[model samples]
Target chain A: MRGKYLLGILVILGALGYMVFGGLGRNLVYFLTPSEYLQDQARYQNRSVRLGGLVKPGTVQYDKDRLELRFVLTDGVAEVPVLHKGTPPGMFKEGQGVVVEGRFQEGVFQGTNLLVKHSEAYQAPKEGWTPEEVRKLIEEAQ
Target chain B: MLKTQTPSRPDALTWVFLGLGLLLLPLGLYLALAAPPDVNQGYLVRIMYLHVPTAWVGYLAFFVTFLYSLLYLFRQDPRHDRVALASAEIGLVFMGLALVTGMLWARPTWGVYWTWEPRLTTTAILFAVYLGYFLLRGAIEDPELRRKAAAAVGVLGFLNVPISYMSVKWWRSLHQTQSIDLTTGRIHMDPAMLQALLFNLLVFTLLYLGFTRFRAMVAALEEAKEEA
Candidate 1:
């Protein structure tokens, strides 16, 4: 009976230890914004990191191979040039948020791939509205 | 009326296992502290010392469940069924530790807390399926039926363990592959670190056995009380 009680106590203690120390296991990666990365550039240089921001307008350029691409990722304050070797996703466009993973080399962020983030407010077009009607409504709202 | 008393004999195997567990603590500590940091990953790689051992022991516990579940099905012994259930509970605890430690290690290395990588996702599913085993056992009232249902789940859940381990190799995943192979005695680590990891593995295995046996004993006692 005493042995059983001791076992119960040990199990309870183990459970409690898990609850307290478990956070160390869960939050392994800390997210950083563009400005945060810039502020700590010296410490983070040459290390693998993730950069997330909007694809700056008028900065996208595609190569002859159609697979190689370049774009500028901006967080309104500064823009970082990105060179990617793979094909960009369909939703990857100007003014869209994207997260790229790679190392920062020679002041340029060379990304291996791009993940395009879609907005939550996407709405389907009304069934009754024709293109002409929708154009008129847009004109009136503007 | 008086009850008859029989001579009680202590289980020597349990004591030996417990001694082995005690001996491992210092070795695991030595490995964690003595090994030089990795040239590329640095101190973060030390997390592997604890994480890998926990994962291995979790797999060991599940294997025990699979064997006992088969025994229960063939022999129709409630004792084997109780042992299987107790082992599953312990297995869940160790698996939870593995998942948590994997996440902690990933954050400093992978640049994200969670990813949709194949290995990580499959392990997560494996954890959930085993958790469901406990819930299913609780919801059923008939003891015989519960044993049959739980045995089926135990067998099926064990099948996922291998798939989780191999998912990294079989699919595209950001998670890294296994770093050490014990069978070939081929390990890539600072000598001190390898020693620490092996020590911790032994300690954790002892802890797993101790807990499972204790849990089984408690389960048996509870059943005896119910029968009374």
Candidate 2:
């Protein structure tokens, strides 16, 4: 009886293991810096990829009416123009480090998700001190 | 039915752990909430004091479950199975807290409540796996069979833990990588913020220790009662 039960358990485990490990290749989206993504443009085009880089200074443009955001992502060596359809995250700003996830298409990275990667250093507001004075407290903190 | 063995009771060490948790947890919370705001994150960062620590402890709890489950399999000891159950119960609660807290943190910072990011999705899967473990236990009535099956799950569920931790690194997760790196001994934070986070980690670790011990004793008493 124990042997029979053991065989059942083994078969069940084999199936579960196959599902998890087998699906990993399709499920995992690779993270790449801007340069890396550019280095292999053909491989990533039309495929979901996370492009990590700094938000190029003076490159962020937002249309509040349409909720469309456009920015340039740079790894200092290469820059990719990203067009996103959403409100930028709280910490997003020019010169901020960010990662955009979407597909590279027609000379632009069309982003479906936008995330700001904040600096590790915890610094205080430079001049104005207000838990209230800020328009959007979350955005200003950055 | 007469009792043959004394039901387990928490010993002095349990008291010590409980005492330390009671003492330091509040202090840690005070430091976390009342502490100065981060330059970049401001008041929103307070969530980390709770969110990060709960996640750390939650992961630790599941790790305990995994360890005890492996031990139970090796020795075929019901005592180890009991320990695994106790730890997993605590772990489940911690994981819930981590998920909820992460959601709360995401709203203000990420500009949205939830996303299908790798870290979040993997963690949700982990949460389901552990929940399934408890359900699996209840579904099996034969003690030995139940123990064998649950132990397998208890071990397999642990595979998600490492994946969750490394998700931010392996994939481009919106969730940031861990602030404190135990592997390289690198901590990313201001002194005060790091201090509060470290204190909370300590308190939560003690709390996990004490809570798991109390839970195991209760499990032992339950088994004794069932036998009697």
Candidate 3:
């Protein structure tokens, strides 16, 4: 009985070990950058893909009435224009790192979802700073 | 058979841990609330007080299970098996808390409650593996076979813990990197926030210790009843 149980354990562990480690490469690329996607545009044209990069500073165009946001996402080497509908997240801003999920249509990426990619750094606002000043500091830092 | 029998009741140290942790929990919350807001996320950052500690306990509990599972295999002792079972159960609960809190934090910050990012996917897998551990335990009828199978699971399933923890760094996931990087021992958080996070961690650790001991005692009682 003990030997039988041991064999069962070995089989299960082997299968799980393969599932976890063997798929490492695919899992490692959770999202692709603009540069990566641009390199092989035809492969991702029809399928839904997640594109990650920085929101270009001067390319943001938002229509609050229509809840439409348009911007150029860049990876310093390549850029992809993105169009997302709905209110942008609180942390979403120009020059911020972001990941958007959707498919490429023509040249623009039609984003179904947008996510802000924050950094690990955590700093408190400087003492006695006005809200306006704080906003300025945030944009300036970006 | 050679190891000491499992204690049938909670010990003094167990009570002490429970008491101190419960007593300190409110204070920990207070510190989290009072901690200076983040320049970026503002009050939203307070969620880390609960999220980080719960995840830490989940990792710690699984590590304890892994250690005890090995001991059970070598010594053929029921006591180690019971401890391993209790720790894995608690680890699952704490890991669930971590996932829930993370989702809540993500909804407003990341614009979604959940995503199929590397870190999230790996954590979900880790949770499932432990759930499988319990299922494996329940499927076997003979006490010896059950313990042996569960111990094997407890040992092997823990591999996902490290994988889950490192997924964010190993992959370019949407999840932020660790503020307190365990690898480099460098902190990127403000001092006030750090103090609050550390205090919460201490309280949660104490609670986990107490809960594991208490649960192990209960497991011993259940085994005794089964034998009778």
Q: Give one digit per residue, the lDDT tens place, for model 1 in A1-142.
A: 4455445545544543453255223313323457878988998788777677788988989885767779998889877889988766544667877777787877788886565543312122355555456545544432
Off by over 4 Å in 1: A1-142, B1-12, B182-186
lDDT of candidate 2 over B87-190, digit per residue (tens): 89998899899999999988877666776667877787777778778767776778899998899989989999998888877776667777787666777776
Order of models, best TM-score first: 3, 2, 1
DockQ of candidates 1 onward, in order?
A: 0.02, 0.27, 0.42
How many clashes in each structure? 4, 2, 0
The CAPRI-style docking tier of model 2 reads acceptable
Q: List, residue by residue over B94-147, the lDDT tens digit for candidate 3.
A: 999999999999998898998878888788778878877876786688999999
B47 Cα displacement, candidate 1 (Å): 0.8
After TM-score superposition, the amount by which residue B80's alpha carbon in candidate 2 deviates from its true location, in angstroms, is 1.8
lDDT of 2 at B224: 82
Q: Rate the local accuracy (lDDT) of all candidates.
A: 0.70, 0.80, 0.88
- Compared with the true structure, model 3 gives a TM-score of 0.90
TM-scores of the candidates are 0.61, 0.81, 0.90
User: Per-residue lDDT of A24-97 in model 3, one digit per residue for the tens?
Assistant: 44556878999999889878779998899999999999899999999999999999999998888888988899
